[model samples]
Target: MINNRYDFIMLFDVENGNPNGDPDAGNTPRIDAESGYGYITDVCLKRKIRNYVELVKEGEKGYRILIKADRALNSKFDEAYEAENLKKGQKGKNTDDVNKAREYMCKNYFDVRAFGAVMSTGDNPCGIVRGPVQINFSRSISPINIQDVTITRQARTTGDRMETGSTEMGKKSIIPYALYRAEGYVSAALANKVTDLSEGDLELLWTAIINMFEEDHSAARGKMCMRKLIVFKHDNVLGNCPSHILFDKIKVKEVSAPPRCFSDYSITIDADLPSGVELIEKI
Candidate 1:
């Protein structure tokens, strides 16, 4: 099991793609309107991570995903309670059953233990868990230009195109180029609370992050790739320094104007010995 605190910075780039779309805005790429900088929600990134993990550990034990697309939540909670010869608790002090169900979920599901979940939903309250690992929303270092293009399909659903003599028209969005950065933290003490968070799991996480976009292909997302991943590990179970101070050391310097690729930016790390801390680069 992991015994130290960890923090990391991930840099990824997208070319001619919509990394994340805002449903509220007609499925356009999400952006910081004032700054014109694009951003991807943590939920969107986590979904990709979950997909990668599922692909890698499909038949492995303790790898079932709790928040799968087709699974029912309440049913899973009920099943967990039944496994421990228990029932649902009514969201008060008497939450032994909820704890039992949460334990079962954390023990069986990788995402539940890695990213946590709000199991206290619907009628089967399994309580809530604060997983040791947490990731922030990734944001572009430079402003991005979103381009909307009209698309046409050759055929129609209800009527034949021969009669109408017209193709189905729709819209799609894309980003010319954007480099995004995301930060994450892991607490060893928090992992001790409910999960083992073994070194194998840690390795799998790094693998998933590196290969997340390889299998997720679509017309809307084109030429997506991870550029770099830097991890700062602390020797203590708590931590060596504040996260903000550590993050300040990793700098992204703007080198070229109207940047179209990852080469236009330079990533630098300050060399200062924060005692009991180690730096590891996964990419």
Candidate 2:
């Protein structure tokens, strides 16, 4: 089980792609209204991490993802209650039954262990778990330009086409390039509350963070890579210092022009760390 406090800064870049699009804005890239910097939500990054873990650890014991596509979440809660034979309409067993079900889910699901979940909904009310790991929204260093393009399909998909040479039109949005940074923290104390977060899981988390974009390519996201990962491990479980102070040590210089690639800027870590903290570069 984890015993130390951990904080990390993750750097990544995308080229000719939409790292995360805002569906509310015609599927364009999300941006900060004031600063004009590109925005990638924490949920988007977490989703990719979940996807990567699901891919590599498929069918492994206690490695299921809690929030998956097209799957009924209520069914999962029912399964948890069923594991302990807690029946529907059963009363007075909620206290023990909920705790058991919550523990079972935390032990079984990676996302639930790492990101927490609200399992009190539906038939069985599994108590909520506060996950140990928490990540911030990623924002690009510079403002990005959105490239919008329209393309046409020669043949229409509908069979009720009246014209002989009918074509369907579609729009695609992309950013020329952008480099983003996101921060996170992990609490050992919180992790041990429900699930046993082993060192193997820590390693797997890093692996997923680095390789998350490799298999996640499509027409929208063209090329993406994990540029750097800097971690600060505190000797104390409660943490040696505030996260903002540790994150301030790692500095990235401004680029000459609009950054089109990772090499455009330089990254440095001037870590005069405290007595009990250790820095680890995992990328």
Q: Top model by TM-score, which number?
A: 2
Question: Per-residue lDDT tens digits of candidate 2, residues 53-132?
Answer: 99999999989999988588988988888887876545325688888888889889999988898887886878788888
On the 0 to 100 scale, the lDDT of residue 122 in model 2 is: 80
Model 2 lDDT, residue 108, Cα: 90
Candidate 1 lDDT over 1-283, as tens digits, reads 7888999999999999899999999889999989898999988888998999999899888998888778788888877877878755554245777788788888888998888888887565778988888999999999888988888887776656557765778788999889999999988888876666677788888898999999898878988998998899999889999888889999997799888998999988987949998989999
Which portions of model 2 show Cα errors greater than 4 Å?
90-93, 160-166
Clashing pairs in 2: none
lDDT of all predictions, in order shown?
0.86, 0.87
* TM of each candidate vs. truth: 0.94, 0.95
In model 2, the Cα lDDT at residue 204 comes to: 90
Global lDDT of model 1: 0.86
| Model 2 lDDT-worst window of ten | 85-94
Question: C-alpha displacement of 100 in model 1, angstroms?
Answer: 1.4
**Global CA lDDT computed for model 2:** 0.87
Q: Which residue segments of model 1 deviate by more than 4 Å?
A: 88-94, 160-162
